[model samples]
Target: MEAKQFQLAEELRKSIRGIVKTDEPMAKHTTFGIGGPADLYIEPADTDDLAQIIVWLNERQIPWFVLGDGANVLVADKGIRGAVIHMGKPFRKVKIDGEKVIVGSAAKLDKVVSATVDAGLAGLESTAGIPGTIGGAIVMNAGTYRGQIGDVTEKVCVVTTDGVQLEMTPENLQFRYRWSVFQEDKNKIIVEAYLGLKPGNKEELVRTMEYIRHRRNMNLPTVGRSAGCMFKNPDGYSAGQLIDEAGLKGTSIGDAVVADKHANFILNIGKASATEVKELAERVRGTIKGKFDIDLEYEVRIIGDW
Candidate 1:
């Protein structure tokens, strides 16, 4: 398998202008800092590079996963069998055109928010301190009570499995509460997006972002390694409040602990394994279900092999 993987990497190098690594550690890429090595980790240089790589992989029937900033993600301890396509620095281009901003999918959500806010753009102010890349944010429709990314999104550019680039409008995106068309359509890779914004006072935008940041910092665990929020809010109730109410805070399974600061965040206080985190999450879920009769859905995206 190692030999085949090496051969695959060499073959991929021949066609695409990107970085390719064998047995790349997933731990280094994710925010949680808990994961095994991926068999092949790839970083495409640009849109054309990405398209070429995708087409090559598709032709070879290679299983691949699109990885963003790895914020709300968990990979298995045994790692992944196929390629992990990471849209890194090269894909983080941001171009502002009057009321619309054209940005690459890999642009950091916070950085984009800051940039747009600095430019006196009002729409992205609500997204303030959200982690992960723009691609991941759009796919999950990430937002707070202020607003959602989908609300400002004019269109999204995605590359299909066949390497065909398509410009998708709001109707095609199907954005709604922590969900998007990309969640269901694994074959589509987000490349670029256009966001519509209104002109506003830069001072007001800065104040709004600062307030949001302060609020988030006050509620979330700032010191520990975590994949942000663990569970999606169940309808009308907040997941964190439910877990806290259930007296599950500070709960631990090995080094994986339910954060005291925010019950929704399962933190890696020490050298926590994926299995430990999974068990801890399950325990939290069971307790919540038994107590409230509400089945909390996972906001974290668990990937790779078990």
Candidate 2:
């Protein structure tokens, strides 16, 4: 490590109450089982500590990236520079207040769904079986055909890059199909969110959640190392269906293969490199475009130093 980088890591360790590691392997954190090492990996103790850490990094002009459950991203083989911040256990609390649900950003989506169902709150059933953290769900506006997180989100507590905390309303969030303001602004970090839900029968909510889970299992690739859906649905068509119709399923480049079960998913069958997966994805896109003249957009984020 350079003198400047070493100095920054040592100073950060003393200043914040969080877990800090240098040259941490990114493969251990992501679901795809890929990626190289991160220069600095941090897990903030709490919202206050997270805010402090962000401020310090900003002041130093050091770049950082936030990692949630690591469900929808592809990290490069060259790894990430600077820092990677994870919310950790401290940010996994869920509080139920009558018809409102206050959940920390690091909380898992399925756990929050279960909590709401148990409390007779009916809003998050559509997100059952979805992978990743609440913060990731909010950033991506995660959803199914039934509903989205944006539908019940009233507001969220966020820390700006300047160390200022603010509660932003839904209007400020600007949630659309798989898009949010957070996606555009890397400096704005979510702490927690308030969801307003309606009272419903617990039994009915449970049934709905179960049904959603069943549907997802039936269609999604279940037995592989993957980063969820590879491509977003086109305006009037499903990306999976298009790939399926194009007979691109089971296509392979190195160890990266198009999932047989779900054409939209690209599976890391073995020791697939990031470059291999990206090349396979590009090939799929080219084939689809040539056949149908429709371009496919990636839903999975490709990140790191490439």
Give the TM-scores of the predictions, in the order they appear.
Answer: 0.98, 0.97
| Model 1: per-residue Cα lDDT over 1-306, one tens digit each | 899999999999988889999999999999999899999899999888999999999888889999998999988999888999999988899999998999999999999999999899999978888999999999999998789999999999999988889999999899999999899899999999999999999999899999999998887798779998899999999999999999999999999999999899999988999999999999999999999999999999998899
Once superposed on the true structure, which residue ranges of model 2 sit more than 4 Å away at CA?
2-4
Clashing residue pairs for model 1: none
lDDT of 2 by residue, 1-306 (tens): 667667788999999999888888888888888898888889999888998999999888879999998998899998899899988799999999999999999999999999999888998999999999999999989997788999999999998998889999988899988888988888888989999999999999999999989998898888768988899899999999999999999999999999999999999988998888999999999999999999999889899998
lDDT of 1: 0.93
lDDT for 134 (candidate 1): 96
The superposed Cα distance between candidate 1 and the true structure at residue 217, in angstroms, equals: 1.5
Pairs of residues at least 3 apart in sequence or in different chains that clash in candidate 2:
none
The 10-residue segment of model 2 with minimum total lDDT is 1-10
